[model samples]
Target: MSADVNTGTREFILPDLGEGLTEAELISWKVEIGDEVHVDQMVVEVESAKSVVELPCPYAGQVVSLHANAGDTVSAGQALLTVAEAGVEMGAGDEGDGGTPASVSQSGSSTENSSGANLIGYGTSEPKTRSAKKRSFGGKHAAAPAVPTVIPDAPSQPPAETPASPSNSSTTANDRVSPVSSPLVRKLAKDHGISAKSLPGTGPGGVVTRADVMAAIESGAGAAAHVPAGTSPAKASSPAASSDQSDRDTRTPITGLRKVVSERLTKSRQEIPEATIWLDVDATELLATKKALEARTGEKYSLLSLVARFVVAGLKKYPIINSSIDTAAGEIVTHGDINLGLAAQTPRGLMVPVVHGAGELSLRQLRDSVSGTVGKAASGKFDPSELTGGTFTLNNYGVFGVDGSAPIINLPEVAMLGLGRIKDRPWVVDGELTVRKVMYLSFVFDHRACDGQEPSEFLTFVADCIENPISLLPEL
Candidate 1:
């Protein structure tokens, strides 16, 4: 490892390491410029949207320059550092157009084409400079770039002549940043077929206020802002765009956890023939059991744990329900032990953590495990093993105060069970209409592996267990 012999130059750029990561913060640089690095050596540690990931150097050479400093938010594909090949001379400072460009250019030069820097060799074009731009959750330095102005109460007007580029104007608005609008606003806009771009905002800095959109609908000018640019007066009078300028926003680049989840879900759906079964059970006793257990053990557990307990016990009775199909071996696996997964929603996406040997655990132990798993899932810190080896999955929609839904079957596992809210429903006990706490359960199964008769019977068995807790006491 001599100090001055690297000849080839290669650039290492930031990569989109996934889970909806738009940018990453450079945590540390492992290799310094002038330090020789081998391919696959740890080059840097960058914190992504979900986790801190170490990126490896792809080229073996001496680190010639660090393009990005620590603490900078780097966009995907932006150059992070450059490496010089062994024995290459550091080129002169003068910019020459004969060889391939240097990496410092604004658009950035790829390592494949960039010229090796040398004192006597052919000069290279200047590399692109790193963009000094940063994005903010709030609007970025809201000195509004001069662009066309649209008013909520009045007609759209041309922007006053100004010096800002059109590209900058398109993205500088604050409306593009707020991802969490109320559900009512979302539904209203969706029903009216109105897009954010078609609105003349009434909120701060011409941002679209929900009330502004509602008013536009009520006042009969709903079509005004939506008209196509430069249309005739009669056609322009209509608020709905004549050509329907909206297509599903499907052009987004697939990266991160979303990509992984999408791929797995697609594969599972395509490969597995799923069959769903529904059950409306009187959960009056199940709710009573939960209250009693919480009171006796002085431990806190949600309805999710209660449902998980039922699922684990049911899978024990119907072991086939907790199995994965072995296509290679041409066999169906019936799990003897249960690793029950409880579906938890996080900001990143839905994740399931398994309760190991769930049948072996007492009710209290099961509750505690589910509580910890869900807590870790919400904070996004569960280890990879905690999420794997699930014999069965449970999605509790009751937390959202919903009634019933057919949840998608988790991959590999034969079935997933959904738990709805416990509400009072009329049940005929001894031929009398009495109000009993009822829950709607939907079981989704892999039709290829699960027999149609077994899924319905399994659901009924789970309902029976839930209804009569004393029946489970004999097995326990």
Candidate 2:
């Protein structure tokens, strides 16, 4: 999609973000028109159906145009922006919003320092000699021509007038147009004297996330920022208004990530012949083991991590539980790597972040990896690649304080393991009645992949690990 502009310009088009992702919502522009951008420098941030990611540009030159505005949906191969290559003459229009410095002549090397990581597609690997040659359209690379912003598959609207300077605007939160989601995040920004609208959002569709607030707080981006002391993050309304709001049913259009989740879950339910089995396990030893390990090593350990370790062992002893039915190929695909998927709940929605080669990681390393991936759920920064390639999934419904659930299998994966909250309950221990910590384990599987026997064995093995933690030591 590269086009020649003048004798030295390249129209940068969006690249395929990830597997099956055809479109993404343009969140924001990192570089405004006339500003210089280098290869591997993040030029725009977009949220696809899979995840939110910052896109690095390949061209190192002055930005001449932004094809779409924030909140606009852009498809792959669509022109994102145009960049005027280095060593090119410029007119007054070549300058950015404020104005380009005389330093434009020296933009060759001064503007080419790239040390950022490239994402799924497009970036540092792109070349510098991709500029377009002259054409006969009665044009001389019209420097920064007044081109209409192109938005795909949406209603037409007049283009927004570009501001004179790129800086924070002095406006009230109510008056300022920004995507602030949670009231809690608003309060955080308000407490620090900063405006949530001013801080960059890292959440889905540019919605501000709690992690974004903490980052702002740590960076002192909130210091001396104004948020009215009396201003409530929640919108205030009269009693009559509140009553009217309650009367009308709210209908939210599911489009981005939510749309994807809906389609996949529906497919899982409609296509896969799934079955659920449950067992109540005594978790007294598992809890005690987690506590003992933490006390002895002076390092915090999560119960989920301990249970995940047990699940990995169970999968190894029973590999059939880790297989998927490839209906199209008429074969069962048994993945070699134990790419364990953790059902992560984020502000955006439910996401499964897979830990590649989870079986290879030690207990401590496993804990760290799980913790780090789940931690990113708050910030909504999970890369598209991290959300796929799973052979099995682990869902902790207990985190929501639920006892048990027959959750649907994450498709392409044959089975899913669910953990319930451990609570004090009466149980017979060694022929005597005693109070013990007990939790229900729900194992869901695709009947097409395995029958009752294999899944029963896997669940029983995991149950044994919970009942007697010592049994896992020999296997480890």
Best by TM-score: 2
TM-score of 2: 0.68
Query: If scored against the real structure, what TM-score would every candidate get?
Result: 0.55, 0.68
lDDT of 1 by residue, 201-307 (tens): 44322334457556756555444545555876685534445224322222233444455568778888788888778988888887788789789978776777766
| lDDT over C-alpha atoms for residue 383 of model 2 | 77
* Per-residue lDDT of model 2, residues 246-284, tens digit only: 347343446568888999999999999999999999999
List candidate 2 stretches off by more than 4 Å: 5-7, 87-251
Q: How many backbone clashes does candidate 1 have?
A: 24
For every model shown, the clashing-pair count is 24, 3
At residue 314, give the lDDT of candidate 1.
78
